[model samples]
Target: MLFVAAMLAARPGLSQQASLEEKWRALFAQTSPAAAEEHIDAVLAACGDSPAALRKLFACDSAYPQLGGGLHRRATTVVDGETRYDVEYVVRVPGGYSPVRSCALLLAAHGQGGSGASITAMMQRGLGAEVEKYIIVAPTLPGPRRYAGAAYQEQAYLKPLAWARLNLNVDDDRIYVSGHSLGGHCTWHLATMFPHLFAAAVPMAGVPLFEGSPYTSNSYLENLANLPVWAIWGELDQKGPGTLSNVHFCRMAAERLRQLGNSKFEGTELPGVGHAGWWPKPEAYARYLTSHKRLAAPEKLVHFFHRARHGRAYYVEAIRLARDELDFSRRPQPKLRVQPGESLAEAAIRTGKQVYDKSLFKIWADLDKGANAMSIRASGVSAVRVYATEGMFDLSRPVTLRFAGRSWTGGISASARCMLTHYAATRDATAVICNEVDVDSAGKVLVRFGPSGGGETAE
Candidate 1:
């Protein structure tokens, strides 16, 4: 209703007003600048007093249409009760946008307390389309959010990223992520969180991952090493660099992944890239993304995107269930179905960053093409849920549920010996259940989640 006025308007004056400016500009070839100004004045009067109508006199584009080649829109995505930001992005594809592959996704998150304006400043200073080669997404930021730890990236960059792909012809196989300072730290988490999602990651002058820092574990880096990584920081960065956290973390991470038999990862330490100086990310990060495909699957990439957009709860649980081999000897054939219109041919499974999960099920997610139906087999619990949808997952509501009725009272007890050989069910009281089930790993589930009987827990 707020925009109803513009929606109902005739918009007839736009064409007439636009041509008037064209005629005026043409006159500039033969007449004086004074004459052009006179015509401009005439054009304005013909258009009218309304702002939208008047813009036509100058041949200006409406707010949403880019003046040259970019996207422009303003929407309020309220995060916390007290915080709100203007999420903005500018899409510019030189030739045209494509999707089966994936256009690059760049998240320009800022350091602690820096406004979204500062992030935009960095992008404009050196990150415009000059030599850029990917789609850029700059999420709105609070002036005080930390680059490394502001939970904002998950909310801003991650979710909108899913929405972004919906409208643009983005390459599904190549979404990339980046940031600076605090953003650098956040970028680290992004790379680690769903290591398989990004083709590459670039964090500039980011605060280093200090020794013993809870978030600096090797698990994340191990996950990230599947692809190329480029890091930059000023020699003078004092926040965490005085301690060499930024430079050394990369060193330690590279070494750890190598020890783990990962040889595809690369790390760069700029001799002079400063802690907060404007960075040439388009140049460096661009090279990283185009260099090589990190050797993963499209399903993994889409799953990564799904996790980023949706919360990781279900995604994490699914990852534990994705592999063909579980810690227990029994291998369940249960598969996870992505919502309709998701990608296919998923990537290989990779490790993800870890913290603490007090819940019985540590929910996890990754894109999977090989999985026919996704299910879980745990120490005390086992479950499954099919997405029932197709390729190119939509994580906004990325899940569905399925349940079966069998009353033996309590399901898998915390002490029950439950293993999914292919399917699992139990019909007797006080026992691990493996009732009427087919344990089809390659069978597609029609929903995303299943049942919770007595003593059954999935949260």
Candidate 2:
């Protein structure tokens, strides 16, 4: 067609990328899983380890004529240390797409035992009219696995996002994430672990805080205080005897957000509907998602971590957690019960013993009062950084950092240096100003001091 020819001619040197993408799709479609994986390995072997080469091989740009609309199969290599393998994903580019203008991107995760193709089809129908306005991406897990675990999140979700940022005309401010059932749980994990990356999120019929799950005690709900979240559930959607019901999880999450003063969180309970109701009414979820945009930085941030698996959130970076904090987080809380005549004070004391020291290494920062300050009762934390002028701190003024019974002072020069280091690690162009400081590893680190006349030094 003339349209296809014009598109190919407009983007020079795109033919090879298009060819590779087509071959990958054909191979995936025609061959058995084992044969397809073998062919993928061979194709990726030819591309080598060069970032530029890999990008081109994956068709990271909008050069493929078939990508303008409908589902398109693409392959990319996910490198985990020395090991590397090719993975497949499906992307649906809205009709009438233009390279000059960036459009919203919806990262949809499929349910258990589902592939990118099936998920993409479901989303197209579920999202209804909203599908016409955005680009939808669905990633298939390797092999025949249904559950999305930590490995899949890194390989399928995060890697694809990095690729999309480089290749597609994506509006960074409008990137959204959503999922159903098992995918919904993955949605919660992804959104909470990396709240800064998403504008909004919708998790349907999934419970991230069920007993025996790794996320049970390590619910990073506070990290999502600034992100808009819409959680959906059915009253009768309990999957099994030991499983936590979606309704209970969503209600508890909503209540927790409310207690934290987060106004952007909402929980929608579908009456008389079961776990599968959300797929039939995609427009309902779309309504909550379309108008929201990501705030690259917020004035206040709270982040909790169980381990070093996740280190950064918005403007706050956790260098490390104290040994005691990690230990306490892992320890089970005592179940307290009040006697028949027990006073409220007595009950409080019993409960406090179990949960009082839970936040020993928690991080909290606030800049609404027009000063750069933070607080952390952390012991053995090597370093922590409070980004300046990323809407979290005022770099023009002096900073007063107080922690572990010590006070540190720094000026604009120190803030600038810290900002540069943060920019280097994250490569986030939006962060104009940021700062970092090493904490005393012996005791608590609390930012509760006055300004210093020096340029940049912790004294």
Candidate 3:
């Protein structure tokens, strides 16, 4: 509450801006998603009518609350079968931490049978003195085996990261995720599904491909095009019956990345090293993690996804994909292997239905904000939402969108609806969008506007 009071006292001048600030405070103060969304309506109402003004207001980054430094154990609420429970996580705030200086965040997930406390302790040991440059967060990932999937994404990762952003001075561009073994698998999952949220990913001794339900990392290789991946594993880990070894998967990933035109991936295989590979020393680890920063608004983006929920890469999102079951989940089928004497085409024809790539969706988008023009190439995707922020382009100019050989060139007005709705959904004020343009596969253009404005369409 004192932090809220400080924010109120810091800005005293105009009543309008002050009113919006109060609304923001009220919005962030809500603990639950439903409450937060309900509060967004009030915030939108307080913004009057201008989308540009709303963008400016929301662009004001909130100051980090005065939270003393230390390892703090926090709990986030989660729901299951109409019942709710609390999930615990550990956050390591560097000694002598100050709200004035922004620091990198490291999401250290633990392996099977390990808890958040153990992972946090391991990070403290590994990072040593260099840990002072980061705020390390370790969540006791949910599920009996502490699996890394959609549930972990929401409860363990997203919730904790949201808390850190609101309460700590976290550098959005310097965030990193790393894990070992099962945690390493989680690291790969997080990096593949949410590359936009991380600058780099370090996965030690874990392969994304494992026999399991809900598929593995093979289908999402293109998503790693821009994210720097440092995959380290023992050459002898998990090599046996029903296993293809971590080194094998890492090598395959490197090859796939190359095929995807990605040169940002690196795979290091240690001789004789087993499942528990190794971690870089404190100084080296810090230097590697801090050397890279996330590209907030890349001019070009490539993303491939099996589920539409993970379709967001950066400025482009596949809001509506061509797939019937966007949230499909099932045990993965065996790959269509080419028989000893069968031709590759023959093998595909025989078991092509078991192939993963055939069912995937992809979107390639290039933005030329200077010309106010953007082009998109999509496959198995029905519709996309393109976000426009002041950081990406000048919203004051006419924006042109081209898809499927059709082009629409018109001025796009910032919409309060788009701004508020996006903020409510993401809770990320750093990349809050001013406006969004929704386009369909057939070249239909829908520029979303708030209550004060009307929808505009172009062929």
Candidate 4:
């Protein structure tokens, strides 16, 4: 009789959980960021505002389809500008895949003339015995061989990763990305833009956009300071007669990596290898990929970005960039006429100002939980957001932030809304924070909350 009564009492709780799960499904389905934020706020209002309670409610796992582990080709919708189309990707699940045991996930991309199947086969060949332990997903480029664009990045690369996280028992800490040739270029860009998503990156024979027509000479190589990067290229690889050799770019990246104190990065220039049809030892590559795990909360983060969408790394997010610093139109035109005594090289330097400085945003931050304080240095950005967890800040006491020759000390209140906001954006539970504070360059708090019932903001 008592057991029966207990079951009856638990019925309402079970129903509530199911309802919350349904809401979470819908929340993740929302495409627009603003729409997602609205949904999150609504859910917080309907549910309680306690982050612990909400996190527990949102932690429930869903049922997976019974597709007995193997290579499965799946089609996801891709939208590029006005056109929306279906693109296929290949996912290889080990035969031993089980929901009970989490497995590492490898997101690989293919170069031009290569399909998803080809990259899967390539990884399988490269991984050899190690392949069986990983769930590999390879997405073909939707149209051109460019992974730099939105369609390829959002739909082709990240969507499949989201799908795997939702459906499979993926170990978030062990996720890695790798590619070859054009895919290698994609790997470099993805690693630079989304360093938070992977444990390490293996970019094979790809060029980092340093000295190019489209991109300026300045590089975002500092962003890779925390990410473990293994870039391999042939010493003999050259793009064309007038273009610089692949080795030159690789050496430049290596130099930058050294300057940034990135011991994890390795740029390999094989003696006789060329741009195509060759790779370093597969076993060695596999060893490097499996060696590192994702750092959920790093003590420091050095991030640089050209686009607002790619402004976040670790706990620091650039909300608004300084327009005057990033606007090419505001820059003075290059000197067309050279002085009579000036050399040709001097004239070239005067007239040639090829850089993406106008759009670049720089953020450097160090979190000291022991001191309950954070120190930040920012450039080319007017506003920034700091998402703080227990690992980053002591929520119970007043948190101090020193930035731009000013210090702001305030008590940080934990909120479910803040947690859900990040969770909704990342879909990664590790990124969910206990509290968040937005401040402009002058260290004025723009928006910050205090206790659940005391949300505060400043104009």
Return the top candidate by lDDT.
3
Candidate 4 lDDT over 275-305, as tens digits, reads 8878667789789988999886788888876
- Cα misplacement distance, residue 18 of candidate 2 (Å): 29
On the 0 to 100 scale, the lDDT of residue 276 in model 3 is 67
**Each prediction's whole-model lDDT (CA):** 0.41, 0.59, 0.71, 0.71
Which ten residues in a row are the worst by lDDT in model 3? 208-217
TM-score of each prediction: 0.49, 0.68, 0.83, 0.81
Error of 3 at 301 (Å): 1.8
Ten residues in sequence with the least summed lDDT for candidate 4: 1-10
Q: Give the per-residue lDDT of model 3 (tens digit) for 1-459.
A: 333343344343435346656676677666543346567776666655556555455445453467777889988877655656567899989887886567789999887788889988888888888877889988887756645465444456767877776677777778899988878888888888788988999987776632232234466777787888988888778741123456666766777677877888887878877776367677776777888998767888888776656778788888887766443445434566899986554354335324555677789989887888899989888888888864776767777888867888887776777776666544455676777788987888887763465677766
lDDT at position 162, candidate 3: 71
**Which parts of model 1 have CA positions greater than 4 angstroms off?**
1-68, 71-73, 80-104, 112-121, 124-132, 148-152, 207-219, 225-227, 234-236, 241-244, 272-274, 278-284, 293-459
lDDT score for residue 345 of model 1:
16
Cα lDDT, model 2, residue 351: 57
Question: Any runs in candidate 3 off by more than 4 Å, and if so which?
Answer: 1-12, 15-23, 32-64, 79-86, 146-155, 209-216, 239-242, 326-354, 415-430, 450-459
Off by over 4 Å in 2: 1-70, 77-86, 143-152, 209-218, 240-242, 280-283, 324-361, 372-380, 389-394, 403-405, 413-458
Q: Choose 1 or 3, whichever is better by TM-score.
A: 3
Clashing pairs in 3: none
Q: Can you list the residue pairs that collide in candidate 4? A: 326-358
Ranking by lDDT: 3, 4, 2, 1
lDDT computed for candidate 3: 0.71
